[model samples]
Target: MKLLDPYSLVLMASMMCGVMSAVLFLVRRSFPADIQGLGHWCAALAVQVLATACYSFKGTLPDGFVLPVANLLFVLGNGLCAIGLQAFYGRAQGWRMLGGALGFALVGMVYWLFVVPSYTARVTWMALPLTVINGTQLWLVLRHGRRHFATYFLAMLVGVNALLVAVRGALALVMPAPTVDLTQPGALQGAYLVITAMVPILLSVGFIMVATKRLQFTLERRSASDPLTGALNRRGFDAAYTRELARLRRRPRTLALLAIDLDHFKAVNDAHGHGVGDKVLVRTASLVGAALRESDYLARFGGEEFIVLLPDTDIELAATVAQRIQAALRTACDSGIPVCTASIGIAAQTDPRQRLDDLLEEADQALYRAKANGRDRIELAEQEKRRASA
Candidate 1:
């Protein structure tokens, strides 16, 4: 087998990076602006393409121009990767720290390239900062990224890249090269160049995978949630019910459901238009959400009706929650656009065999009774009678 020359490998890396950068730039436009980081990553890949192009001209161009420029662009690319990861994870970008690090690394690279004139020193300077940047990216992925195959894949690639950079920096101290030219042919140099050529492609694949995972999650969330009120829709409620029922079955605990209906909701819509009605519904959902415990589940059943599932709660405790929601609605009415009150019906599952549909039917019946009895009061569903033994 014949080995490719270092110059050829460098040129290939530059071309590959340019293609990947363009691919990322196009892919980024498809994602929502709120989905941050793709822009930075795209820019990083473009900068890296330039960096490798400069390196490919090492023998042709003046060392003073090629060496410092290539190393600086390389470091800048890594720094941008770190920033992109931070943005993707919804963390502070810390631009000042990044600027300082890049400035410091550039000064060191210039000193080694011109003032001191040591190739090993320049390599060490470049590799060390890359190691730090890649390590930071690895940490962000592990700490903040979702536990998915895509997340772990990106993390693995980044972690290995960081390790390789650190090893290269360490090798510069232990095994100094005879020549200052990066294009010099040797086994280690070839291997390094090969890895440099391949990693950007691998990293881009990992990034796309992660972004795809994020898009999947976002779509799933939107499907399951009410866009107007930000509450779980009926589909989401059904899934939540299944999970809650399974959990309750394991623990042999009570599960309570509260069916809530906004009283005179149509009157509000008729009087103040849908825009104001939307504000009322959003405020009502917010208030109900605040009244419920963290473990409780809230879902928009349809129109002005919402449902709440409270695990490990009896009918009495569920009534207390209902009262709290009513109070919240009353307070909201006093302060906001339109006056609104919610009539709540409570039903509790004492038997593990009780199905979600049966519970929902009971709650709905009770809700009808609440509306019939007054309008803004709570009604408890009558417990089912056990069959008589023969």
Candidate 2:
């Protein structure tokens, strides 16, 4: 009985906005605090709360102002949301943002001046564009891997609202029937009661799911990552390496493995204390990560040692990569450290008979030789040398 009220639905929508605000706050903590996209989300949620509250107080507003004000606020909230989506996805570039903004402005002006005066006019045209813009944004989210949970949440919102609009549209066509009562809280009133009952349930459930996903990601990162370096810890590294090895088995291809050990690392830890050594480690990791392509994998194997996996790279190319990593680490600056160098051992999947574990052991043996012969140089696997000689 209580579910038939429109104001109840408006209150539920406002509650959803409150939940969204909490999600934005939690997500912001995991990322860099000064991110611009987070600010846009906060602004958009504020507008949505205001719009929903306006609808909740519709009976109290003056006659001419109610419809115009509520719909206008909806337009503002959705428009700002579109802009925020563009920015958050990093697609608000060049002519695309300009074009989207122009379209929003044009439709907003026309709706305000021409459509708001007559209720029928608003239903016939305004609802279609609203559905299209929201649906398009959901499609964009599915296309990009980032913010996929956000996209899915928004898709449910769009679909539910589109269904509401369609049902209302069908009722408008049969309004002249004697059985219809446009003001009643029933299906005869264009199923307003049905939408009012269902929309709040959908919105509330969807908001809860989105907030849960955001919180889960935040929790997983804190538990699985290194606090000082933002790199994967031992647990994370093992999981990633195992997954990569399985994937490599499925698609047979050339793979290069490099085992890197910091030269004279104990001297620094002894001379300057562990703090300086940690700084040097972080700086070295940053340099190596920057030098490699995004597809390449790097992980801290243990104290003062690292491992890198380069897919589709042969031994020759792996040597070149090892050299780049060495040169980059040499030039890398760490606070209160003079200079740092690394000795790297290079190995690759050259033989069809070699397994991932075999490749790793060969890389480890070559790393020992690199440390044995000198402090800072690349050592190739002996089998690789024999292949080249032949």
Candidate 3:
């Protein structure tokens, strides 16, 4: 009994799971939403603990209650973890598949316990469904989880447990010498006890790692964005612009920048209140963002100003996009706002060696000219005036 202390390890693992669940709850609140799938992960932990508790009373409890019920809970826990993995990847999962698997597990358990009389048969029956669930989880990680270290670690952990389960089932079904009981304290039984007790907590840890990794990524992205309009802030935009310049040097493509300023934005704030002004800002960003190509990048450049980077774009397309933004804002302002419009300044990189700051300064000059030209228009930076064009 002391040597085969599955109960102690199972209980300790359950306690660890409880601690992690509480930790995840706190960690989850810090993220944007329930993107971590912490709820399902925590529920899986609790379900696994409950399943183990049910199994701990194997002989003390009735076979019908202990065998089918405990196994069903175990399957449910695994299903939830699988769903959690899908959720973490921002993928949609078919709950019907899990429901069918769960139903099969229950039906198999009923048939094995009531119609069959052999312990070996019961072992193989439970093994098949459990292996299927584990294999499904492994497939998910292999398919969609290449970007993160957590995926690899989790796949390895689950793979080992799954192999152990398959081997255990094979041994129970085909071993020539029959054991007196599953708890007979032989090598096979000892290995089985250790695996069954240890795997739940280990799998829980893997779930926590993946969820935490994803949350970290989301937090990093939000940190680089304007919280109000979900546009890249000045710091984030600068980083991206620098990277694009490096790429442009190697690839030698025409990169265009559009510096946009909202016309009479201060008056909109003064007359209509800052709240409406904020709404206009959000609406402007949204409308202009929609008018650009997927490859084009938009970023908030502080106070009713924005920068759009159009990689591989010439001045013609850049001016067209600026005009589209102007038209979009014209209609938006006419309908929702009394008097709101935009003035855009365009600059194209003629020389690949042009610095980002210089490019921006030329665009700023054009922007200033647009403002000086009675606003609500577009101005192009004079390329001939620059020390080097573009």
Candidate 4:
């Protein structure tokens, strides 16, 4: 059987690469500026397109001009891929090492093209650097990326590409080809061209998927978080409450809630302005967060009010946490913020059937009493008569 035209495959690969590069460029324009790596990846694809385009003109153009430029761009494109992964994973891009590798590859390409004119030597020179770059990219994804499908998919694609490049380089040394021209047809050469053409398209798909997943995760986090103080918002608290209730059903345990209202918060706003009031809220949230255990959840219920959910804690322990928050805020006065204190109401539930509304209501009533009695104090909610009867 005859092989498909190698030059045609190279042309097809160049077109596919160009299309993918354009797609990534368009996608990147819509992405947040903080998300790094897409630009690098887009540039990498563009460079690869140019490399393959130059390579396709192997017979038509001067070998000295086309071969060196094509191979140089190929090496640069692979290096850019490694740099892109580094930026994606928030790691330092090793520019010096990449520069050294590019320089070495360029020197080898030049020597083989003009001085020696060996096909196998040129293939080895190009392939080795690409293998290193691809291997580095695979390692970065495995080490820094989240353990998920998108991470594994990208890793697998890069690992396969690296392996192929390495094996091709090894084969070039062991089994030298008859001709120096890339357009020469052979089964191995045809397979390599097809695989190379397909891999970039698949790789672009994988990149888009990974980036989309990150964007989705960021949106989810922002939805659940309070923009002002970075605490959980009411909706976020509700989700947390539901999860805790499910856990409580699995194993019976005490769950406690603390409703905290900032004392004289309005006075702070009136005297110092809303800017100071915002700072006080932020400081109060920080102090409360510092006081709580890892197992606890803190949320901004509304303006000047916060809620804390403590799992495996009784009313006494909840009261201790409330006092710790009060103490933390007491020290905040000296930290260049307006003096702030929180009136806290504590409620604990041993029954898994109790809804969050019931717990919140009891805590709110106790908070009302704490404010009525005197501000800046902790009050424990009286157990319901239904609980006493039970």
Candidate 5:
């Protein structure tokens, strides 16, 4: 096949990438939780767009413009990708920032040295850093390769990068003699356009799809989680509790529920306006969540009230858990709420005959007693039962 002829396969890839970029942009707007990550992805797509443009205008654009534009795009895109990867792994700050800055500086040096000289030197200088970034991205995916979509996307990226490198080599080998035209290449003008255009497009499509889905997932999570406290909202809490109850009935696990109401919570809300009250709620939720085991779940039941679900925890252990929670909340301090305390009503399932409603009823009764007993106390349903029996 003549290297000058356009490859249909490459053209298809370019179209796909453009469509995917649009789709990813729309999807990114939907995710507030993953906004930073989505921004990084958007940056990556911008690079892909630049790459596509470079491929299209290769011979037409001045050598000065072409090499600097193309190489710089790749560098920026790769840098954004690294940042996005770090964000995904929750390690984007500190040393990673230092590393990213160093990488960008090196990329700028390469652009000045190679792209300013000639296309051939530009391609040569571009190879190592491009490979390093692509390889590092692939390694990250491989390390977390169990995710089906991530693996697929990473594979696609690797394939596209390899194609780019191959095209660069072909471009170098097939160019006309120095006397004829330093600007225009003879052998693979058409082929170069096709490959360069198509590769970024195809890779962009895969990346956009991945980024879009991730954005959607992040949106769903944000919908379910309380923004201030990181606990499940009323709807989320109900859904979770219902699911746990249903699961427990099938498997018959020892389950407990603690209904925690902050004493004088309304006073806090009234005294400091809603903002300070929100902070207190957030702090209290954090304290309570920290007190829980990984297996346990804590959620905001409603304003000033929270619910905790403990699987495989008996009545005694549940009371102990409640006491620990009480202590933690009492000690919590941020922006000054004075001394805060929670009145927790704890109930556990001892009999397989009991239902979730029954458990809740028992716990509620215990809570009423705790409030009646003054405030700032943990009262166990089993303890109430003992007193009633006596």
Candidate 6:
């Protein structure tokens, strides 16, 4: 446990950080949709680890071999952090902007390493660019991460690290010249070295938390939605239908259900194949969505059948929606692989005492009638019979 000195300590810490970042990178790849730009975050940490390793070689290696590469990767690593966080918030870092900054850092490193070869000059050059990258990250988190505490902590870490770099750069201008040798104790040198050695682990932890949360959210959403058309799946539909029924009980409002079936969908699959039929299902969902309003719900009830809930809608309005959806499907398939149409059966209930199963059964019966009357038509449930019974 002699891991106390600046050089040895940094070497160990950087190695561990590199491993953690690499592992997290692999995990993020498993859910690429949820954690966008995580690959960049992983790359940044890996580069930072290498840069720290180069610092360990300070006097042992030639400046030409170590200085420029280390500083270049250091700056690039910080830049990638900014880029990755920007992606998390749906903001993108333009390549032109990134390339320009990266190029400038490289040019500066070459000038200092070859021409001046001063440690102070290299520190000043590396510090300023790192500050800008960190500052940009601070702005992104503040602007978009207000709701997430993980993001707030991330911003704070970046902010402090940026300030430390700025302070080190300023001290280099005033303090006497210091060599890359770690044996001699200098205040600014020891402080910044310790920080660079340590911050990556904390930063990695914070970013991983952010990524984990995003992955969880995405998984939850996927569970609720159909993979093909993005409509609510049967399980999700049942939950929603239950909620709508509860609402009807709390208040005296009309609730309508539309039981919809795709006409000749089996034939579409048989003639055009399942691939084309899937496209038709997706298109059918889109068309149904277009016909519905904000207070409506659409679910893939089962194969080739869908259920729609129209809140505060009566039989007439529901019938109109059903007709519009049928027409929309007909038009949508006019030029596609095969002609497609829909049969919709609607049922409405204004009484708070009515049961959900009763409503669904009425709608299903009406759907049967529409099929009996020939496909691609709308049918309404027998409200009069229920009214007479009540």
Clashes of each: 0, 0, 2, 0, 0, 0
- Candidate 4 residue-wise lDDT, 272-385, digit = tens: 899889999888888899998887999997799999999999777888899999888877764557788889898888788887899999999889888998889998887832
lDDT of each residue in 51-75, candidate 2, tens digit only: 6777666578763455556655665
TM-score winner, 1 or 6: 1
Q: TM-score each candidate.
A: 0.89, 0.67, 0.79, 0.85, 0.72, 0.75
lDDT of each residue in 177-216, candidate 6, tens digit only? 6533344555545666677667777787777777777777
Using TM-score as the measure, name the better of candidate 1 and candidate 3: 1
Provide the clash count, candidate 5.
0
Q: Write the per-residue lDDT of candidate 5 for residues 89-163, one digit (tens) a residue.
A: 565433364356446545655565555645454455555566666666666556643476755876767656765
Model 1 stretches with alpha carbons more than 4 Å out: 178-182, 249-251, 333-336, 384-390
lDDT for model 6: 0.79
**Residues 304-343, candidate 1, lDDT per residue (tens digit)?**
9999999888776888899999988887744549879989
User: What is candidate 5's local distance difference test score?
Assistant: 0.68
Clashing pairs in 6: none
Show model 4 residue runs off by greater than 4 Å. 111-118, 178-183, 290-295, 312-324, 333-336, 368-377, 384-390
Best by TM-score: 1
Deviating ranges (above 4 Å) for candidate 6: 1-5, 25-38, 82-96, 111-128, 135-196, 242-255, 290-296, 310-324, 333-336, 348-354, 372-375, 384-390
Worst 10 residues of 1 by lDDT: 381-390
Lowest lDDT 10-residue stretch of candidate 4: 176-185
* Model 6 TM-score relative to the real fold: 0.75
Using TM-score as the measure, name the better of candidate 3 and candidate 5: 3
